[model samples]
Target chain A: MPLKSVYKLYQDMETEQSIISYKGVVSADLLTSVLNIMEDKLAIIEESVSIRKKVYNVLVECLQNLYHHNEGKGTFTKNAKQSISSDKASILIISKPADFYEIKTGNFIENQKVEKLKSKINHINNLDKEGLRDLYVSILNDGEYSNKGTAGLGLIDIARKSNKKIEYEFKPINDQYSFYCLNVKIN
Target chain B: MENINLEGTAKTPSVSFEYDNGTIELRGRSIPENSVEFYRPLNEWLKEYSTCPQPKTIFEVKLEYFNTSSSKCLLDLFKLLESIPKDKTSVYIHWYFEKDDGDIEEAGEDYQAIVPLPFKMIEVDEI
Candidate 1:
């Protein structure tokens, strides 16, 4: 493929109405900086306290997932190389409209993990509030904490609060990796 | 312990507790950056309150939304309420849900089923 064509594809993939977008290595420091900037922007919008809290939580969960799960460096485990660019990094975008705030994060994942993720989303989407609560409790009791102390409840919490279907897409990046995009909207 | 009063943040809920009256109110959204740090003191206050036990204790939960972590903390609070002596302390839990928010209403009911305290599910007009 020509260099120009590849560049065009990259740009096209990034097309979005991003109030805040970060493309590079994901780290706690970088995430904090982005959150600080976003908080200032959100403050100016004068959203209600509840809405503001929801937005902040959603952003934190998205960014932390990217930082912890991004399969970069020598850790080429599973479907790492295909979706995420070991050299290029991941992307996060926060957009706002009159009615809602949308947060989107894109990172690379293994092809094998896609099916499981899709199934999980489907299961969550099918649940009512009580079902979601039961699932959360069951998961809490069953699942071990991640290295970062995450209980794997982030997605469930997102689903519970959002009360909306999570939007996602997977684009083939290579043989082992594929770009994964997850979007959550808070109104 | 000193009274716990924190203004609500975008991700954190507003909290006001009076040690004297044993009256506490939690309102707004609760998805705190550090759930443990945010809830620890409140839990402590409840524990202390259980010992002295005010005659009338009312906990007004008017939260619009909360995440799973916050839900766990809430369950802890309700359990504390269950432990208090009924005669010495009369606990009234007023759970407020938005009129149109069926999810919140249902959640309130679920809590009522588990908690032994007198729980009332009240609907509030939408903002």
Candidate 2:
């Protein structure tokens, strides 16, 4: 896989602790594999259950976001190797910092939607835990009764767990597409 | 009602609930692929248990991990436990965490703050 080369590129960066990295097309199977790797690594850490759960939850939300917002045009067929268009491919990196785990995911987003996402993350980062919980409950109930999907609870969950501000950036790829980078620090 | 027993997976947890003794155990990881589907039966069973509860119900939650959706479901489960009459039914929650994991310990404390029930946070060795 061409993606293997991407992994090879990161192998040369000699760091104090091992840096586990994987670059691949975002799919359910790939998501599960990544979670398995993370769980295996986290198991060795004492008192990691809560952190493990938070990590798992955050990854799920990230993958689901990719799936829901995938800009790919072709339908995926069984038994057929569906090539992910360069614009549709998403990259996720989980790196262990000295004091925290840094989870970063980048994907193509429409140039127009970048501002909305940035503003949303900013707003969520400002709320306290109680406020976030109240917002979550309100959204859940409102979405359920109104039949609205994607109530933006994933961002709220991320904010609640990370307990830190979300750092993100948008790099313009072209007129129509921009690369969206989302970074969360779990301390 | 029938019992609910299932093993845990990398993204999900194991559940073993006996209707006779009302002892329910949730162990292992819990990050279900589809939180809605994974928790449907557990929620239904809890609904049933509410109507016909055992005298003493012991809930052991030894989860290494769970997603946000599962956290909501867990709160629901504890809320159900809080509903039972204190005299007719006694509920004991054993929240197990690894000794070094501060996150799990804090989670147990957070739940205790929310639910009005007898919940104990116990630190255990690696499973």
Candidate 3:
């Protein structure tokens, strides 16, 4: 791959209105730093306390989901070739493109898991605001935790809090893996 | 039973459970990476406290923010509180949210609906 010029990278960020963008392994320490940076940034750009809280809440769910779901170093597809970079490395970009702010995250997942995740998000997207709230409460009351200590409420909570449809796409990395990309909009 | 007084951190909340006074308090952000692990001690403490709880138990939660995992763990915590026999200890919950923080306020209302405990919603300048 040719190395992109620094100027071009800067221009890309500017064009996208990206305030913070990172592509690497997601870690606990990194989650803290990212949240802190966004907190400072949101404090300045957003004035309403309710909206700020909504954005911050959605951010916590998105970053924590990435931290938990990241598949550690493995084979990933880049340019249709088997490339072994930190396959666990994910991408996060926070931008304000228009009236709303967008949080975009991409991570690698086993191809087998794609169908279930797709169904889950589609189910959430179909729900109205009231349905989303009921689902969140029901899951919370169910009191089940995955091995990673998640309650499976992240996406629902994100949707309920943001009041927006979550945008997503899955690109096949290989037969073994696919990249799961999620975009959440907060106004 | 003894008291649990834990300091708050960037990812977890500060917990104070006074066995004698029956004041159970949790204050701070609760975005722990492993919320189940972080809350295990409190769950155990509540289990023990339930055996001979104080006459009037007051549970207080003043969280600035929490992730979805923490939210479930909190429900688990409340379930434990609900299990305490009312005859032994009259339980009351004080749920605090910062003014204008509609998300937190609504979260408190949601818990109040499902937890089966008398909850007093308190709006404060900050928590």
In candidate 1, what are the lDDT values of residues A135-162, reduced to their tens digit?
Answer: 8766754565555445678888787767
Question: Per-residue CA lDDT of candidate 2, range A1-187, in tens?
Answer: 4988866665643452434555546776877777678767777752556676666667667766765565533333333565335535787777775677778888878778888988888888888988876776666434431121233577787877787788888887656667788888786
Candidate 1: where are CA atoms >4 Å away?
A1-19, A24-90, A94-102, A108-119, A125-133, A137-151, A160-180, A184-187, B98-106, B125-127
| lDDT of each residue in B1-127, candidate 3, tens digit only | 7789999998899999999899999999999889989999999999999999989999999999999988988898899989988899999999999988888998998898899999999999989
Docking class of 2: acceptable
Per-residue C-alpha lDDT of model 1 across residues B29-48, encoded as one tens digit per residue: 77553565678888998998
- Per-residue lDDT tens digits for candidate 3, residues A1-187, read 3466877888988988998999998899999999899899999998888888898889999999899998746654466555657557999999998888999999988889999999999999999988998888888887588888899999999999999999999988667778899999999
Answer with 1 or 2, whichever has the higher DockQ: 2
Taken in order, the candidates have interface RMSDs of: 4.7, 4.1, 0.8
Docking class of 3: high
Off by over 4 Å in 3: A1-4, A76-86
Q: Candidate 1 overall Cα lDDT vs. reference?
A: 0.75
User: Candidates ranked by DockQ, best first?
Assistant: 3, 2, 1
- Evaluated with lDDT, which candidate comes out highest? 3
Scanning candidate 3 chain A in windows of ten residues, the lowest lDDT window is A72-81
Better of 2 and 3 by DockQ: 3
Ranking by TM-score: 3, 2, 1
Provide the lDDT at A3 for model 3: 68
**Candidates 1 and 2 compared by lDDT, better number:** 1
True contacts kept of each: 0.05, 0.24, 0.95
